[model samples]
Every structure is written in C-alpha cells, then in structure tokens.
Target: MKPRTSMVILFLLPASLFYLALFLVPAAWAFYYSAFDWSGFSDTMTFVGAGNFIRLLTEDPVFWRSFGNTLKIIFVGGFFTFSLAFLLAVLLNSGIKGKKVFRALIFMPNVIATIALTTLWAFAIYSPRSGILPNFFKLIGWEAGTKFLWMSPEHVFWSMLIAIVWINVGYFVVLILAGMDGIPLEFYEAAQLGRLSIHYGVWKTPAHLPVGLRHCHWRDDAPADCCSQYRCAPPDEARIPAILGENP
Candidate 1:
C-alpha cells in the first residue's frame, strides 16, 4: 500500500524467488513422489493413493515406537538438560574460581561432532566387554555385581537419552549463562548480600535480587526456579521463557 513498502518488496522479490526455486520446488517434487511406489533410481512411478500413509498408520509399529522415543527424548531428556543447564548457569554466574575452565569443559563437547561423541560413548563407556563403567566398577571391587550391559538394545535407549542430554545441555548452559550475564551485576550482589532473617527463613533478599527470595505463604521448587518472575526488572516475569525465546 505504501510506496516504501512496495519498493522494499520489489527489492526482496528476486532473493525470495531464488529461495523458493532452490528449496520449495524440490520439496514439492518430493511430496509428489511420496504418494507413489517407485525405486528412487527408476523413472516409472505407480501411484498408490495414500497406501503408504495407510500402511504407516495401521501397520508400522517401528514408526510408532520411533515416534514415542522421540517424545520421550524431547520431554524426559529435555527436562534434565534444561534443568541442569539452568543450575550450571547459576553456578557459573556466581563468583567462582576456574570459571573459564569450567565453561570450556562444559561447552567443548558441543563443539565435537555427534558421531565422534557417539563413538567415544559406545566404545569407551558403554561397550559391554571392555567399557569404562564395567572396568571402573571392577576397580572399585563391585565388578561381579555391577556388570551392566550398557550397549544392549534394552539399555541403548537410555544411552541414547544420555547422549542426547550430554550433547545438548552444554549449548543451553552457555545460552542461559549469557542471559544471566545480561542481567545487571547489582542483582547478583543483592542476592549475595541477603541478610539472615526470620521472615523468610535463612536469608531474605531484596526485591531486586531474584535467586533466593520467595513470596510469603508460597514455598517450593516452583517458586525457586520461577524467581525471575518474582524479580523486579520487568515487574514479575520468568527469565527462562525469555532465555528460551518465548517472552523475548
């Protein structure tokens, strides 16, 4: 409607067209092929009319298992990853020694390739015969009782979940640390300066400090993690939603 907007669209149109041609055209072709029965190398495509979809829905236990596994990883593994990351972020943000070394130690795993990490975990830690866990248990005099088969199919899902958490937590830890760092240093100081009092128990932080303070009549794990909301910077708001890009 506006002249400047029209000119901006005109300027953006070429790149937009190029992107659509590069991405959407091939995606459309793939969608078309997905409905047919054809070897990828063959030219003839026998249209199956949702037959693949029907088979996948009604007969694919493997697919459903995979779907369930994905959900479990996303929720269960995600919970540990995010929770531990937040804890690590808080710990690292506090005045501590070897902060940089700790940060690097936590984050360097993320820089390594997933395949490389998998190889290390599989061979060095989870391998049934010569794995580190079994060997370590033996060294600790519990080999007979603790000969855990970590690489077995029954246990591999848990291994996968561990691997997923290990790979992911570092990145989010760094991210949350960055967000925590963005907050004014005064808040952290206030949290540390909280005086011991009977009102809120051990120590009562000022309104500006979020970490240790909780509303009266409400005390639990929920309030401790949700302290960013009980904070004063933006009135009452959770930093996690902001850290994860929900409130941002």
Candidate 2:
C-alpha cells in the first residue's frame, strides 16, 4: 500500500474505534434488549420472540398517538422553522444595518439552558391564567384565561412546537447563514447577468439559475474547483469570532 494511504488510515482508525464503542455497541445492546422480556431493572429475563413488538403494534394507542404527533410536529413545525430561519438568514445577510446585533439577539435563546427555556415557556408564557400570552389575549378582548396550554391535549402539541422552534431556529439560522456566506459573489454576478425582462421597466431573474449553474460548474471541474469554489473558506476572518463572540 502507498505510504500516504497508510497515514490516512492511521489517522482515521481512532475515530472509527470511538464510533464503534460509543454508538454501534449501544445500538447492538438495544437490539438484544428488544428481543427480551426484561423489565429493565430485574434479574429474571425471558425471550419474548417479538411478542413485545406484536403487542405494541396491536395494543398501544398512546404509542400510535405519539408517533402521529411526532410526524405532525416534524412536518408542520419543521416547515415553519426552516422557512423563518431561511428568511431571517437572507435578510441578515443582505448587508442590513446592525445585522450583527440582530443576529446576536436572535441567537441569544440558544445560550439559555433548554430545561430553563422549557420551564419559562410552560410557566411564564403559556400559563393561561396570568401568563404573558393570556394577558395579551385579554387585552385583545378574548377569554384566554380559560385553558391550561400544556394540559390540554389539543393545544399541547402546538405549545411544544412553539417552544422547540423558538429554541432551534437560531442555531439553524446560523448554519444556513454560514452556508450562504460561503457562496462566492462571482456566482451572484453571473446570475444577475442572466436576468430577463418580464414587463415594461421591470426585470425578473430566475432565482434558481445561480444554484443550478453552481452545481453544473462544480460537476465540470470535479477535480479542481469542486472543493475550492463551492466549498471554499470565506475571505472574512471575523466570521467565527462574530458568531461565537470573543469570550471563547
């Protein structure tokens, strides 16, 4: 084998071992446990032979409800979170004044502990009787003090989605903005050149042209510009410091 290939293998060996130990081992153990009738804390163990899986499939209403709720949250909440984050990232990246301050303020929720944020959402924001949202609703002439937000099955999923989105959108915005920042200005210029006139004194550009062109360019130069232009580091050195702050 080549010496360079040997060195690459040597470097990756530790990470491969770590993944096996931390992830694969636990996954295998879980598979084994799933086949048994172990109460998770007892000594006696019985082989269930897929009996537990059959029971869950036929008998578990709450399990099915939870699964449905999870799918609803992923599709509905994910759409809202992704759309909002993308819009915010585009606006933030548009050379807006005080963009850094806005980004920091948006990202501030990420610094707060998850449990603390959940507690605040549950008690202070959604308490229904005297909470901030209830008070706001009362001011709008609606009877908001009648229901406990988290206790009601109908509203609990939405409340959870709101909390999750509030906590997560910031992190996703940062990621999407980082990706946007990496896109070269040359592509945007090329895209602008491809603009078409739609009506009188009005020009319209195909929004997807730049992304499509970028992929085509990368495919043509797979060995060279593939990992450089589309995947190059930004010229700005302050990006990391701006995102993480100077305390680190």
The top-ranked prediction according to lDDT is 1
| Residue-by-residue lDDT tens digits, candidate 1, 98-207 | 88889888998898988999998999887766678888887898966457888788989998789889888889988998888798765455335433212334444556
For residues 1-248, write the lDDT of model 2, one tens digit per residue: 99999999999999999999999999999989999999999999899989889888899998898899899888988998899899999999987999878888888899999899988887788887656887677787776454445537787778879888888889889889889899876545544533321121233334544432322221222234333434233233334333223333
Any idea how many clashes model 2 has?
Answer: 0
Instruction: Give TM-scores for every candidate, taking all chains together and pairing residue i with residue i.
Output: 0.70, 0.68
Off by over 4 Å in 1: 1-23, 144-146, 189-201, 204-248
- Clash counts per candidate, in order, are 1, 0
- Candidate 1, residue 81: Cα displacement in angstroms equals 0.7
Model 2 weakest 10-residue run by lDDT: 213-222
* Pairs in clash, predicted candidate 2: none
Q: What is the lDDT of candidate 2?
A: 0.71
Best by TM-score: 1
